[model samples]
Target: MDQKTNTVASILFMVTGMATVGVIDNFITYIAVEVSLWQFHFLRSMIAVPAIVGFGLLAGWTLRPLRLWPVLGRNMFLSGAMFVYFGCLGFFPISAVAAGLFTAPVLVMFIDAVWSRRRIGPIRLATACLGFLGTLLVLKPDVGGLGWANLIPVSAGLMYAFGNVATRKWCEGESAVALLWSYMFLMLIFGALGVIYLHVFPGDPSSYLTRGWVWPSASVWMWIAIQAVFSLIGIGFIMKAYLIGEVTYVSIFEYSMLIFASATAWMLFGDRLGALGFVGIGVIIVTGIVIAVRSNAADN
Candidate 1:
């Protein structure tokens, strides 16, 4: 594919990934608030692993160079981020968590500049600051309005953003197949540990293995299985974006997930944002456009 074709393809991949991930994440949020993070993580990963792996093999994915360490590092960070994200979901409004997570692109830019020594130009830096201001407004930082739980999602955003940066800078040359599968594998391990910590180590193991174990409702299982099936494609698209675009640019696509989530929330759950929320959404949209436009110019 030519460069322009590749960029568009990557962006589409990213958008679709985020759109589908909105489904997965909201469903998980729906469930996790009622159950422990351990419960959902185990059930989701138990299903996600086999499904992602089988599909990868069927699609003729190969693991050339086998870079397991970087995969481990990046995905461990992601796993921790997810723990915090879901924990926050259990405590706060879904839109609130989504707003916090949108700070990731700004965080990614700053982290990349600091770690990679990339020069932060005036435009990029200004956009980052503006985006962060929007986040603070949504969060009502001046009021200290959001509780400690809000920190969970924000922390997840930071870690997830940093992981994307690492993916772009250090692991771009790796096989997309390897990166996706390896990250899934890593999540499986982390999820397994979550299960073990909660279930196996229970002073009364029976309570966990039998009593409190999350029995995924039929609908929840369907959601997870569908996610397991589709997220491989989602992750592949994201990996391609990481390879071909700047991390800041591709990461901004995450805000697109927020857009999808907001619409889904309103349609499915009767959720609506207030004035500040709308402002935050507008900032997210505007900054995302700026990032895309500037990145396209640089690409040319």
Candidate 2:
């Protein structure tokens, strides 16, 4: 396909993937009331890993990683980020959690600048500042009752940034399918650990983060299956989008997840955001566009 055609296709894939994720993720809150985070991850991965393998085999895609250690390291960070991101969903609005998670691109820029010993130009630095301000506005941390939980989503963003760096530095040339397999496998492992730890030292049954295994109701099982299926579909499209399109151009479309998630949350759950929150989301989206454009230019 021509470059323009490829870009259009990529944008479609990216938007579809983001919308899928945005919708499925809001359902996490529904299940969170009934199951522990660990149990949820464990069960979701249980379903996802086998399904991924089956699909990989049928499609004749190699699931083995070219570099095992790097893939493992990348999965560790990415899985950890999801762990935190999902955990936050049990407590915060999807819009807030998603806005924080989308900070990954900005964090990636800062990490790359420091690790490469490159000076940040004025525009990039200003963009970073705006991004930070946006995060604060979205999170709206209460100083009087400030606690670590308020910053959990940003921590997820940090881990996601590291995972992105690892992907570029070490997992280059690896098959996207292989990376996806390894990531799901690691999530399975992490979920098992969380389940075991909680079993040994259980906490409040009602607490999603602390609660251990519970017999899932039919509804819980259904939602989890839905989560697994939609997540695979979303991830597959996102991987394809990156493979076919310019990274800078494709990455910008990911910001669309913010809009999808926020809108879906409002429609489905009556989750509403104030004017300042919407403004904050806008700022973050604008910052992400600036970063993508500037990064592309710098590469040229």
Candidate 3:
């Protein structure tokens, strides 16, 4: 595809993928009430991994990584990020979690600057500060009485930034399918370990994160299947978007998830944000766009 066509198609794919993810993730709140976060990951991966392999085979894509250790390292970071991200979904609104996860770009800028000994220019430095301020607004630390739980999603973003850096630095020749599979495999392992740990020394049954495996109700199974299928669809489109479009240009559209998720959550669950929260989200989105635009200019 030409650059123009690629850009347009990528935007469509990204927006659609984000919308799909936003809608499906809201279901996690319902799923969390019935099962542990570990069980959700375990069951979802059980359904998703084989389907990924089947699709890869049909597409004739190479599912093997060019370098195993780097792929595994990347997987470790990405899967850990997802673990935190989804775990927050059970306890926090999707918008807050999305805001926190989207902070990855800012974190990436800082990480790259530190690792490369590059000076952060005034514009980038200002952008980073604005992003941090926006995050505080969205999270509203004072509203809920600040606690460690509030920082969980930001931790996810930090880990996700590391995963992104690893992908660029170490997994250069890896296929998307290979990376996806490794990520899912590690998530499966993490899920299994959590389940085992909880079973051996069980915690509060009412707590989603601490609870052990329970025999899933039929409705819980339904939601798990929905999450598995829809998440794969979303990830596939997102992968395609990055493959065909310039990363800097395409990544900006990812901010659409904030809009999509927030809107869907309000519609589905009446999850309302105050005026300040909306402003914060806007600040973060604009700052992210500025960062992407500057990064693109520097690369060119």
TM-scores across all candidates?
0.84, 0.84, 0.84
Tens-digit per-residue lDDT, 1-300, candidate 3: 676677778778877887898788878987999999999999999999898889999999999889999889978888889899999988877766876787776676677668667776877678677776776666544445456876788899889877766766677666777777667878888999999999999999999999977999899999999988899888767656655654444555666676667677778788776787688779868876676556535532
- Candidate 1 global TM-score: 0.84
Candidate 1 lDDT over residue span 1-300, tens digit each: 676666666677788888877765666554643345566666666776676567767888776435667767777776777667766666566667766776788888889889888688888788777776665554444433667756668888888887888887677678777777677766667666666666655543333222245566777667666656666676777777777776776776676776677667777787765687678768877876786677756432
Native-referenced Cα lDDT, model 3: 0.77
lDDT by candidate, in order shown: 0.69, 0.78, 0.77
Worst 10 residues of 1 by lDDT: 203-212
Runs in model 3 deviating more than 4 A are 1-16, 128-143, 239-254, 281-285, 288-300
Residue pairs in clash, model 3: none
Error of 3 at 241 (Å): 5.4
67-154: candidate 2 lDDT, tens digit per residue: 8897898889989999999998998877567656877766766676677787767776787778767655654443225466657887
Question: How high is the lDDT of residue 132 in model 2?
Answer: 64
Q: Candidate 1, after superposition: displacement of residue 109 in Å?
A: 0.5
Q: Give stretches of model 1 more than 4 Å off.
A: 1-6, 33-35, 134-144, 203-212, 296-300
Candidate 1, 40: how far from true, in Å? Answer: 1.7
